[model samples]
Target: MSRLLGLLGGTFDPVHNGHLRAALDVCEAGQLDQLRLLPCHIPPHRQTPRVDAATRLQLLQAAIHGEEPRLVVDDRELRRDAVSYTVDTLHSLHLDFPAARLCLLLGTDTFNGLPSWHRWRELGELAHLVVMQRPDFSATDDPVLARWMRERRTEDWTDLRAEPFGRVLFQPVAQLGISASLVRQRLAAGRSARYLVPEPVWQQIQQQQLYAAP
Candidate 1:
């Protein structure tokens, strides 16, 4: 049986429930042996995170510390000091885990903007894409993306064990209507972010007074 390694990368400004839940869901859904929650140093697609990479990495460590094997935090992108590109991370992972099936997990929103990513097409060559489909998204609506999806779509993840890369699998997972931006807003407003983020992360936020108005 080929080991399946999953990578979920993001700018975890303050690791929240949604991020953790999505990581857990993808691990179980994809039967991934280890799913690394990667923290980006400089996000290529989005604005630079308000919090520093070290702080965000600390929050990620607190959020996933007790949970090992199933979930772990990868700081390669954070340590690189360059714009975090998914393709670069995938390429590195491919070299590290040559025998295992490498899968990159992304939400539907991310998948929809796949073309905008740096070297997006090369991503599939390095790792299988496990796109988490949302109830409201329609990737088929885009002519270019629709054609791309058509050529690489696969119905079974078992096929991943046979081949190392170039498969696109769309799997439906529980969509929690949570966002890190919302949590930050709540924290900035001095409101309760209790349920929105994990306790350890919440504690870290309070301890460090993160996202508080200056």
Candidate 2:
């Protein structure tokens, strides 16, 4: 069978539980052949992490726990400079693994911000964009179908060409509604971030005293 690889990239500040579960969902729920645990060197919009890149990578490696036999941690971003960009990362991956089909995974909040991403249009040509499901689909729901629908207006049978260029696809998996920032806030306040992230990650956050300042 042909294989498709999913790339989940983030700072993974402490490689919390929710991030791991979401990636796992992408694999099992999306029937992904494999997943590459990509930890970015520098998150563009976010402030510099309290913990450095290596530390974050270490946390990611520890959190995998082998549930995803096909999952692997990719560290090219770490080897690169500051402020990592997804387009560049994907381009490099394309060069390194030319035959593999690359798909990016993100939540609704991130997906809604794609239009502002670096070289966003190139993404449509490079690989596919997979948006994880949120709550109900409101009419104002950013409508990922536009990537195809707009093109269809110039052609016939719009619905027939639903996945043109495989630009955008949505998969709504069950996940506890939580945020990483919230987890950090709870930890800093001496509150338990129970079941929000993996046990080891929470331990690391506490032991490392991460997110305690500011």
Candidate 3:
């Protein structure tokens, strides 16, 4: 059987419980052999992360420490020193793991904005897209995306194992209303993000005074 590898990429300005939970949910639900938390150096669609790549990486490591053995970190995007494009990252992963079936996990919001990404159309060619959606989530209204979804969407997990790429799976995960922005906002306002982020991550944030008011 081919190994199933999942990739969850983000700035992870400060790794939080929501991110960890979602990753673990997808990892178990999808039966991934390993799920890497990829922290991008430069996000193409969002503002630059407040913390540097090294600091963000450290926080991610802290958040995942002694957690799931399968939850690992991949820092290829940070080393690249260029705009972090999903297509480029997928290509690199394909090279490194030629036989592994790659699953690119995404939130519904990010999946909705797929049309705007660089070389977006080619995403399905490189890896399967696992969209983490709410149970009540409805189909997208965009005609182009709707059509694309119809072409690639699959409900069965077996379809992902059957092919190395080009399938889309919508998996419902527990929605924690936490966002990295929200965490940062609370910290900057001298508010506590105790349960929003892991204890170790919160400790590191305090130690470094990251995202605190200037």
Candidate 4:
């Protein structure tokens, strides 16, 4: 039985519960064999984080600790460059796991802005994309994104049970309001971010006193 793999890319400045929820939902709902968390070195569109690459990876490892054996943490992007590109990562993963079906998991907001990414339209042929609903976004809000989907002849996609990546699939997950930035903000304000991230990660941050004034 060939396994289906989900690639979730993000800066993961401080990997939080929401991210975990997203990955878990996508994996289980999509009938994926595994879900790999890809933490990018450079997010490109967003402001850079105060934490470095290694620490970010540490946090991710700590966050997904009790995840099922199917969930994996892939470090290729963090080791790749100061400026990361998704298409490049996708190509590399394709080569590494030729038999596994690959699908990209992303939030609805990012999915709408996919065109702004480097060579976004061509991505469809390479990987199956899962566009999930976000906690703060409404499906009826973006006419342009809707229009773009129309242009691609990708609309009328009423099938949530379809396999992603032509062999995989796109499925909806429970919307979570948490974000790494939000966790950082809470920590910075000296608030309780407990349960926001894994305890091991929180302990590591405390031991190292991360997010403190630089």
**Model 2 lDDT at residue 176:** 69
Worst 10 residues of 4 by lDDT: 152-161
lDDT per residue (tens digit) for residues 1-214 in model 2: 3357788888777677667777777777657778898888878878877678888887787688666567789999999986788888888988887776777887777766676678776776766666666666432244653554244222211221333334456666667667777777787787887577777776776687776745
Assess candidate 1 and give its lDDT: 0.85
lDDT by candidate, in order shown: 0.85, 0.70, 0.91, 0.74
TM-score: the better of candidates 2 and 4: 4
What is the alpha-carbon lDDT of model 4 when measured against the actual structure? 0.74
Tens-place lDDT per residue, model 3, 1-214, is 7899999999998888889899989988988899999999989999999999999999999889886569989999999989999899999998899999999999998898899999999999999999999767777888998899899989988889888799999998989999999999998899999999999998988888899988
For candidate 4, write residues 20-93 as lDDT tens digits.
Answer: 88788877676777889998888788988789989999888877877757778899988886578888888888
- Residue 77 C-alpha lDDT in model 4: 89
TM-score of each model, paired residue for residue: 0.96, 0.83, 0.97, 0.85
For model 3, what is the alpha-carbon lDDT of residue 74?
92
- The ten-residue window of minimal lDDT in model 3 covers 133-142
1 or 3: which has the higher lDDT? Answer: 3
- In model 2, how large is the Cα lDDT of residue 105? 84
Ranking of models by lDDT = 3, 1, 4, 2
